[model samples]
Every structure is written in C-alpha cells, then in structure tokens.
Target chain A: MIDSIKYKIQICCGTMCYIMGGAELHLLNDHLPSNLKDKVSIEGIPCIGKCDTKEKHHPCVKINGEELNNATSQKIVKQLLTLENNDLL
Target chain B: MTYYNNAVITKHELLVRLIQLLDTNKLLDDIDRIPLEMRPRTNSPIRCCVHKDRAVIKYKLMALLGFNIADEQHELTPLKEYAEQALEGYTQNGNFLTVVDEACSSCVQVNYTVSNLCQGCEGRPCQVNCPKDAIMVLNGKANIDHQKCVNCGICQKACPFHAIAYLPVPCEESCPVKAIRKNADGIEEIDFDKCIHCGKCMTACPFGAISEKSQILNLFNNIKHKKEKTVAMVAPAILSQFKASSAQILNSIKAVGFDEVMEVAEGANMTTDHETNELLERLNSGATFMTTSCCPSYIEFSEKHAPELKPFISDTPSPMAYTAMLAKKRFPEHKAVFIGPCLAKRTEVYQNQNIDYVITTEELGAVFAALKFDLVKTDDSPIVSKVVRPESRGYAASGGVTNAIKTILSSEHNITTELIDGIDKKSIRLLRSLPNKKVTDASFYEVMACDGGCINGPVNVSPLKVSQNKLKKAIQEIQSEEAAV
Candidate 1:
C-alpha cells in the first residue's frame, strides 16, 4: 500500500558510524526482505556529518529520508519489517 | 541456536577495518588513529565511554596485527613501531586466543544467588541445610555469604519458594570442555592446555574481550615480501560463504593477488578415497567402525576426551592439509594459504607441513571488504579449476561424510551409521556412551563439532540459509565447469 514512497536506507560508514555499529549494518543487505527489495535500496555513505552536529545521533541509519537513532541490528530490522508489513507485503 | 550475536559482529567489524588499513598499505602510519578515529566524539558508545571502546579496539587492533594479548610491549614503543618490529621477524609465543583485560566486563562470580522471595521462616531449611553455614536469615530475607559458601547448592535446593537462581557466564556455558574460567580479577582466562580452539568462547563473550589472533597482516606480508607465489586453498565449507559461483570465487581470489586457487573439496575427494578404503579394511577385519576426522576440532576432541576412539578416527589428513599438499606437489615453491570456517584451522596450521597460513571465511570476508572486492559482482572468469567431484563437495553439510562413505561402502556385513551434529555437554555424554549404546546397532559414527558441519562453523559470517543457497549454486557451477589446469 505504501509502495509509492521511494525508500533509501543510507548506512553511515563514517568513522563515528563505524564505532556506533554502523559497519555491522552491512549485514542488512542479506537480511532484507526480497519482496521489499523493489521498494528499498541500501547504500553505505560516509558520515553524512549529521553525527558531528548538535543532533547528537551517531549511529543513525536513514530509512527513506528519516533518521533513526540507535540503528542497531534489532532496531533497523524492526524498522524495515514495519515498513514491509505496513505495505502488507 | 542462532549464531547472530552483537559481540561477534562488533569483533568482525574491527577486524575488517584493521585489514582495510593493511590492504591499502596505510596501516603503518594510520594504525594508531584507527581506534581513536572510530571512537565517537558525541552520542553513546557501546562500552561505558568512547575511551573504553577505543581501549578495546586497541587490543583488537593488536590481535589483528597477530600479537597475543598477553605479550608485553616496551613502555616507549608505539603500536606502529610494534608493527614494524613484528614485520622485522618478531617470533610469536603464548596463547592462540587472548583476553583484553581492559575490555572484560568482570561479571560477578557467584553462580547461585538467594532472591528476595525467601520468607524468613522459623524452620529455615536453607540455613539448616547449609553445610558451611553460608546462608543466613536477616530482615525477613535470606542472604548467602560468598566467603563461607562452597557452592554446594544445598541451600538452592532447600529454599521453599524456589528463590535461588543460578546464573552462568555465557562463554563458560558455550564451552564444551570448560576451558574458559574466571581468574581472580573475574576476567575470563583460557587454559591453553584444555582449549580445543573451537572458537565458541570468542563468539560467546558479550564484551568482545576474547579473540583469535589474526593472520591478515601476516598474510599480507607473505604475499608482498615473499619470493614464492601465494596459493589460496579454498575450503569446501567456503562454498556457503561467498555469494559468487565457484568459478567467480576462483577469479575473485586471484583478484586479491593470489597466484593460484586450489579447491579443498578436491582434497576432500582424495580424503574420501583414503577414508573409504580404511573403513572397508577395518570393517572387513571384524572391527566395529571408523569416524571421519576431517574436522580438526573433532580430531582434537576425540584425542582428548574419547581416547578409546582415537584408534577408530580415520587417519586421513584434513582437506586443508591435503589440498595444500596437492598445491605443493604441483608447485614446489608456492606458499599454501587455507581459507575456511573454523578457528581451529589456525592452530592446525602449526602441525601442517604444506600449509603456510590459514584464514577463516570470516577473515576472508574481511580481506575482501578491506580490498573493496565484491565476490558476487566479480565476473565469472574461470582462471583455474581442479574439477571437484560432487560427493566430496557435499562435505560442507553435516551428513556429507556419510554420503561420501556410503558411495564407497561395500554393503558388506550390514554396516550402520550414527551422527553427532554439534559438540556440547550432551553430545560429549553420548560419545562416552557410544560403545554401550543398546538402542541402535549404530557401529559407524560421524561426528562434526559444529552443527550442520563447516558451513555452520563458528566463524562463518553468513546466515545458514543464505550460505546454504550460495553453496548449492557454487557446487552446480563447479560441476558444470571443466578444469583448465
């Protein structure tokens, strides 16, 4: 149902992101739902520099255009699942 | 059980980053800043603080450089200088695995604790049953004095409300041989004598305190400085690890500067040829059966725990050693580099005459990532193929050895088979009771230390299903392709 929204999950591979477990999210490429493959794209971007700003989110992974704090394996997968299940795929 | 653990991922991430620096020839100057640069300037760190996280990373970097954590460095030495020293032919000694003391969580030692549910009754069975008077009632609650407590657990049983609960350290629980134990400081220590190097504790530690010393930098130095060509002996278990077809994996391995790629499954084919003949010889002579000794950890386990089964273990060399020997036979001056799943393979390299170095599938992934080479994206340019037989290719899974043996078994004298998937306390007990087993006439035994065989090995980074699919595809591709060599 939410297929119209183009989603891009940007994993921060910056120095800060790597420390906050951003490098670990590289495994997400394997865990992503195949059906949702058409809806989302995964890419590793160098620190968006948002982490060094006043926002204070270091391990943030971007889903669509939204930033997620504490973007660990569990949280990121949960967020992805919600997006997939919301579309009811 | 699921192998996806946070600590394990964190450990691998560190290794990959260290390797990236080494791959680019930037490690000498940039190695010191890696831990600091990765340390977060803002937000939260996984440890207590960014400093603490960096401290752990420092030790991890040391391990990636191939130094045991227990080794003492000079007070005036920089890590870069130490790296230079290591490259200058510093001989390594001490344990295979190391504990970064600063990173250890130092959990409490008490296994059993008295909960608040104790009613403080007049007939305090917990107090009464305490042989050493370790338990006492106070303020309508029960408390155990750890000083007096010998950990007999009589009080735990006597408690009426089931208030006493037992807590175990994860690494200790995961270890089959009870090799990992807490020292006086509560930091886990591995008794090198007792360790089988299965690498369960390395993945089980929540703090990422325990790690195997890496062969990456050493491997890099070997390839860069050595006059001899470096040949990669890729394991059968590696079938599940890479996303590329076997043909592509062959090219991808060469992409990393390897001179040759040898299929370890080809070695497995040889091993099967020998193992099958051995089994027939033994069974025909009225011997009960023989066990497959392809798994180095299984061989160690059988030698240490099941001494009686030592004679029964097939005397065949492992795929890694066998393949390396094959490579050496072809090229007299080539250095054999084994890439596979188990950490025990690292230790196995010590006894190996043909193999020069061994890296896990996890480590290979790190090297690939560091070098920015994607196995799946690599073009299928088949450089060399040994024409691996389909039966030996099946050795990646649990029953692969059984099937390989079945192919050659003479159907002589009603031979039977039993299987042990994973090594744990229960499996060890079963192994002990094998001779006395009355339920089944299972004379022949196949025991794999890691559940589901080498694909499910402790260091294999890929998830079970993903690896399995990739392995199947690679086998099919390899089967169809003809060997140019």
Candidate 2:
C-alpha cells in the first residue's frame, strides 16, 4: 500500500531558513530521482531555530530528524542519491 | 489649517467612509473621463487610469478647498497641470492611504461577515465575550454592525469554517500598509498618500495588479559614475536567506558592487541602547506609560487614530534609520541603499535624507538572479562573529522590542514593564483603556501592529508563522557575548 511507505523529506520554511533561500528549496523536488519523489513527503515548518552561531552556517533543515547543516539544493540532492543507493559512495 | 473634531475618527473608519463615498458618488466613471497627459502616443490604459484617478482626487481636494477645478488656473500652468501637480503634492504631504486601507480592511470585510452570521440570540456569546461590546447580534447569527465590530477577528475565531472573512481591495488586503482600495468599478486604487512604497502589494497580487515604478534603469545610468561609492546596508534577517556563509554573503554583496556590507542588526543594537534609555527616562519622569516608536506603520496609526497617544511615543530612531544615519556619517560621500522585508521603508528613504534607495527582500532576490550570482557554488567562508545583541536580533519578531526593553529595565532598575505584541486596531483600544494613573502592574508598553513583528512584516517573503519561529530560534542561538553588544 502507498500508505505503508514511509519516506520523509523535512523542509524548513522558517524565516531564517527562507532567508537562506529555503523558499527556493522546493525547486529541489524536480532534481530528485522520480522514484524518491512519490515516496517522499516534504513539509515546511517554522524555524527549527538551530545554528545560533554567526558563522553563516545555520537556518538549516532536518531530514528524517537528522539535521542537515549545509542544506543547498546540490547538497540535498547528493544526500538523497546516497539514501537511494544505500551505499556510502 | 482648521481641524474639525468628529469623535476622533479612526483611520479605519475614514477608509470605509472614503470607499463608501466613492461607491455612492460613482467616482470610478468620472476617473475614466479624465484624459492622459502623454502627447499623440498614448500610455497604457492602466497608467492613464491611475492618472485619471489622481485627477479626480485632485478635483475633490480642490472642492474641499472651495477652489473649483475648472475655475483655478495661472498663465504658466494650466488647470490640468495644476490639478496633477496638486494631487502629486497631496501625495507628498501626509496621506497615510495604506493605514486607511488596513483599518478599512480590518473593519469592512470583517463587519460584512459578522453582520451576516450574527444571530441575535437573547444570550449573545460574542457580546459577552467581547472585552468591548463591539459586537451585537442583530438578526439571527452574530451581525457585526458598524460602530460595533472592532475587526478583532475574535468572533470569527470563536465561530465554528472560519466564517468571519474580512475583504478589502486586493492590494489593500495584501498590502502591509493597507494602502490599496477598490473604487465603484471594483478596480483597485492606491492611496499614494499612505504608501510607504514597500511594494508588498506588487508581490502579493496574483493579478500583477500593483507595482512600484522601476528605478533600475535610472540606477544603471547612475552606475556610470566610477567615483561614486554605493553602499548596501542589509537587514540581519537576510542572514538566513542567502546560500553563502555570512562572510561570503558580505563578499557576494561586495561582488555586486557595494563598497561595504553593514548589518542593520548593528543599528538595532544602537536603537536598543537608546530606546532603553528613553523608556527609563520616561518612567523616571513619571510619564505614566510609553509605546515603542520603531515600526513605521505603528507610528502612522498613532498619528491618525490616536494623536493624543503621540506624547507616549519613544523618541529613538528605528534600526533602519539609525543604520542609514550611521552609514551616511561613515562614508559621507557614499550613497546608502537599505535592503529588507519592509515595504514602508520606501517612504523612509524619501522622508529621511540619510538613505538613497530602499529595496524589498524580493527585489534583492531579483538583483541576485539578474547578476547570476552562483551563491551555492561559492565556497567562501562567511564572517561569523559580527557582534549584535540577541535581544536586538529578537527585535525582528513581534513584541520583541518590548521584551528587549523589559530586559533592559529589569537589569537596570526595579520598575515594572508590560508587553503586548501582534495587536491590531481593536486591541489598541483595549490597551488604551488599561492605562491608569495611580498604580499599574506594567509601566512600559511594546505593541507591534503586525502579529509576529518585523519578520512577519507585510512585505516579508516567509509566512508570518514561519518567520516567527525562525526568529525565535535565531534569538535562542545568540551567544551571551553577542547579546551584550
């Protein structure tokens, strides 16, 4: 059943995350390998409120409760590909 | 100017009256009657329509002045030119069209639904619950008949499909300023008088119905001046939006030709320091209570609806104004451009001589896209250790200013403080009622018109709820060292 499949992609649409261009993160869905898109559900939440440092590193999104600090579309795609292959390569 | 008092008309009521008057008078048809000023080659109908609307407004103003539009003339300037110029002058003078729209939207749309749904049961839940008996159930469901409905949306919240729907002009509905309104024809009109030129309506309108006049080409032409120094002061809220590290963001801004990247958060620090002192001074002087003067919209509301409340306004400049002033002082010859999620700052730039231009976050995004800045691709490390107070950064959220002020008061003295954020027009009345002379729990007041504060400012890109959270987290993350600054 489609309902049985539990694939999660957490999207951060928080103010800070958005300033980090989180609104544009939705565009990453197109880059996903089609199989993952259906299995995945993306939800935009208010700020996860992490990355309190001034190092230009925060306003991040969490995928499956694991925080992804460098959350660019490219980094996100690579992370997804790794998830799909089930290999560290 | 002879000012007549009429129960101190709320800005919102004035807006409704203006809209009702236009509808009653069929002003839209007359707006269509005025001709475009452009010779032979005509401008777009939309552009001409705006001019025509201006003409009619001018005619009305003239009538108010007892100078007939047809009769007023001089040798060098024709009546048409005079009218257009006068309308333009009127716009330049205090109009607060956006505030009127906001008040109108909060009142009219809400009043309509409340009026319809109101069931005049013997035991009225709405009336009983209303802190102020602003609601009266006339027929069957709760009818929010005018002079009663405070546009609190409390009744709507209390009601069982979110039935209380407030409608205003599309731009007005969308505008953070509440500047746009509908004429008799259902066409949207701007109160250039009240517009701070934040351009939120331009993005909010699905129909592309509202727009700001483009100064891009003018900017490009001015860019030819090799000796001219152009500086872009970015808001701290932008830290979360860009792809690069903080330092890289600065570098990227430099790459875009800005001489230096200064954080508006620094200005926030200055404002916090000054505002704290001002609040303390007010308390010490026995000035029963005071309200923050940071948000331009809040300031505008006080000017219109509660002029008596003006004495309570803090004299401290807003972060944007403070930052621009400092920037102008640092690089006296440089042109300063402030970029943020505020539509009202456009008016700030014109009103204050320290700044040259104001661009919204969306406009800044466009600038990035146009420049083809591959932000994600860049590996530049961002400058991470910029010192700004955590409390100051929290100023991005609603009631944030009050919280920051309260923190200062608590740290320095034993005086009590009270904070009210995310309050609309109705709540202001409640707050006004709470102010007592002798003894009160809260001595200081912090109220933001928009719920969730500046981050949720009408011009912001992120949703209000989301922005509020992000700001909360951001504040949590602020280092104690940084918070001190």
Candidate 3:
C-alpha cells in the first residue's frame, strides 16, 4: 500500500521572505507534478524566524517539519518528489 | 527572490549587506571586503571571471554609496574611501542614475537576423518588403545587411516562416523617451537631459547594469546622529507592500526610529480638492482639457518630450509636495523623509526642498532587513491621520486619481477622463499627438508612469496581482470603517 499521509509544506510569508521571492512560491501547487498533487499540503505562515539565521536562508520553507533553505517553487516540488520516492523504499 | 530575477536578488543582497555594515559602524573598515566576500574563489563567477564580477560589485557599491561611477578618480581608490566620503556627507551631484560599464553586456547593434529556419523560398517576401533595401538573398538564404538595416522590422513581419528574429537591447527597448542608448564603446549611457527618471530601463536590464544612487546612507546618518526629529511621510502604495496590516506597516516605520509617521494620503485628499478646483477653473476658462500633475515622471515627460501639453497640465502641487509642505508647517524643524515606490520621487525631492530625503519601498525593506524588524509581529496602532479619505488611498492605483476627482466633480460637472495607464513608446506617441488633435473627448487626463500605478513601481517588491488584491481589501476595510464612523 502507498503511503497516503499528506506532507505539510509551510511557506514563510514574512516581509523579508515575501520580497526575496516567497511571493512566487505560493504558486507551487499549480506547478507540482500530478503524482505529488495529492501527496502534499501547502500553507503560508508568518515569519518562521529562519531568515535571521547566520546563513540567511530567505524565503525559507518547511517540508514535513524539515527546514529547506532558499526554497523556490521548483526546489519545493523536487524535494517533495524526493521525499515520496524515499518513502516507497 | 524567484519572483525577481537573479540580478534583482543580487542587488537587494548588496543593499542589505551595505545597510548592515552601516548599522554596525564597520562600513569604512570592512567595506572593501564586500566584493571579495560576495564573490569568493569557491563561488563560480557571474561574469567573465571572479575578478570581473568583483569589479562590477565594486562599481555597484560606489553607486550605492551615492557616487556615480564617473566620480571614481583612480583604480586604487578603495571602497573604504568611498564609504568614508559617504559618511562625511557626500551628496549626489544631481544625477539619479549611473551605468556600471563593467556590468553592461555590450549587446550587438544589429537587431534583425535571419535564422536557419528560413526556407529561402521562391516568394522572397522578406527581400520584397524591405523598406530600406536592407535584406538581400545571398546563397539562396535571406540575410539582413546591418549597414542598411533601419530596424523598422517590416521585413520580419512579412516573413511567412517567421525565420526573421528581432533581437533587442532590453534597456534601449524599454526606455519610453529614448534616454538610454549605446555610446561609442557600445556601453549603455543615459542622457540626463532626455531622462524622465521613470526607471523602466533599470528594471528591464537583466544584468542590473543600471544603478540608482541611494540616499539610504544619508537618511541613516541623520537618524543615527539625531540631527533632527525624523518624520516618515509614507505613501498610500505602501499599504499593500507587505503581508502585514497598513497600521502595522506604519507602526514598523516608527519602530525603525522614525520620530513620527504621516500618511501622504492626507496630502492626496488635499491634492484632490486643489486639483478639482484647478480643473473647474480651466474648464470655465474654455480650456480643452487638463491633466493630473501628480506623477513626477509624467511631469518630466511633458517638459522634455511633450512640451505642447504643458498648458493643459494642472498647476496644483502633487500629493508629495503637499505632504512635504504640511510637514514643514506641522513640524518646522523636523526632517521629512518621503517613503514611496518611485525612482522619479528622488528627483522630485531634489527639486522640492521641503522633502529632506526620499527612499523607495525597496530601500525601506533593506533597512528592515538590516535592523531585523519582523513586520508580521509588529504591533498595530491607529493610523496617524484620520482625515485620509477612501479616494485618497486609491491614488496608489492607475485610475485612482481620476476616480477621486470624479467623485467630487461628477455631481456638478460632466467629467470624462482618459487614463494613460503606463508610459510606453505607444503611450508616448499618443501623449505627443494629444496637443495637435482638434477633437477632445476627455475633459480630464490621468497619467501614471508605471502600469497599474505606483503599486507596480519598478522598486516595489510584491507582485502586481497580489498587491492589487491586498490594496483593494485595505481600501474596502477603510471604506467600511469610515462609513461606520
């Protein structure tokens, strides 16, 4: 049986993140591959405070509670697919 | 950052770094390390090599320090020296833009090229339609002769196979007034006399070759030294720039060490009254039509490109001008800073002395990033002014000005308006021809240099659709609150 649990994707919508490209990440749902469309859920949350880190990973995203740095829509989709493929193993 | 291209992200990062250095008081000591730090040996170079990228960054830093690249006296002058000069109150020499020749890609002059897909067909439509006789069929393939080609693009359209491609220099193509062009070295040069400071070319350049001299350091120095009580005159467009509420944004401006915050929408209300009276006077005097005089870029366009329409431009002060005047009256000794989404506003501030400094919404964002001000968590407070009308807040959008005036004049006078949504080559031609046209259908004209208005200004961070929806919601909320009151 395929793992049917939906992966929670939290996108930072803070001012810094919004300006630094988080605005485009909101459209990740439309760009996601058909297979992963039902496998993930996306939510825009207030600043996760990760952008203030020493590395300044702006437009940060959290996928299934794991932090992703400099997250783009494509990067998020790729990460989601990778996660799903690993779950199959 | 994906919303903006790579170049804009780099520019913003550079700004954030510069502001951080300024805040830490390590600007002069560590300024030279920025270029090296940003492009280290480990990182792949964006240009020919790491050294070239460093050179471009150095010149960009010079521009950010409020000096034109032309002001560089020698090759050995370090970035530290420029920082020192900037700290010592080096004012810009009235030029708003500087082109870093090092960053310029030096695009080819030839515009039209025949692709391999060309069939060299029997029809020879390209050769037949060439107005300048610039197309010649050699070796059974159509070729564009650069020497004779006038770039009219007639041949490209006539090609049946779409084999002809028109290559454009983005900056040159985007400029509405033809202010930016390649010089003898093929590097883009801005002609200040022709420049309206609209900043379309700045946004169009993918290489980020064009730099606007920032007054961020100057404003920072003033705030740091406590030279005077600094007052921020926030534009209405700023309401939708971030995900936070309008009240939170204003409160955050206060949290950024601004002693006071004044909404420019208050002045927009003033502008509505004054401009409406001016329009009424013009119509009573048998004037054909009058145009709104709020957009600084449009004003510059009229003075330089469309001189014939000068008589029709209203003489009333802009919202910024009115706000600055009010600030002067309210707090005579306060340093007034106009925070808005405009490059032309810098030039406007320069001409209008009441406004001590001007910074774009992007620069303000950089300041927030440098100070680590989380606007989402900022405390909300009541807006500074209660007199701001719903129509005044609408001034941030394209037809907002006309709509505001229409609300007042529609009852008494039959007012028709023409909105020049954004200034482009096509809109410019229409604006130029307006004076010569005998028939006038519109009584009032609303012209905004940026498409969709100030919310979509070149320096604005948020996307158009997002900002528009947010602005619409904010305006509606304000409308309901006013109705309840």
Candidate 1, B226-312: lDDT as tens digits: 655888888877766754567666777777788888888888888888887887787777666677888888777776667877877
Model 3 pairs whose backbones collide: A20-B1, A21-B1
Share of reference contacts found in each model: 0.00, 0.04, 0.34
Which candidate comes out best when scored by DockQ? Answer: 3
Against the hidden true structure, what lDDT does model 3 obtain? 0.85
- Report per-candidate DockQ: 0.12, 0.06, 0.41
Model 2 CA lDDT for position B176? 48
- How many angstroms is residue B242 displaced in model 2 relative to the true structure, after the best TM-score fit? 3.6
Docking model 1 quality class? incorrect
Give the alpha carbon lDDT tens digit for every residue of B423-455 in model 3.
998988878877777767788999999999999
Off by over 4 Å in 2: A1-89, B1-180, B192-206, B213-217, B220-227, B243-245, B379-385, B410-412, B431-441, B465-485
Pick by TM-score: 2 or 3, better one: 3
lDDT of 2 by residue, B31-87 (tens): 222222211134343224555433433343333222333345652333344333332
List per-prediction Cα lDDT, in the order shown. Answer: 0.73, 0.54, 0.85
Q: Please state the error at residue B400 of candidate 3 in Å.
A: 0.9
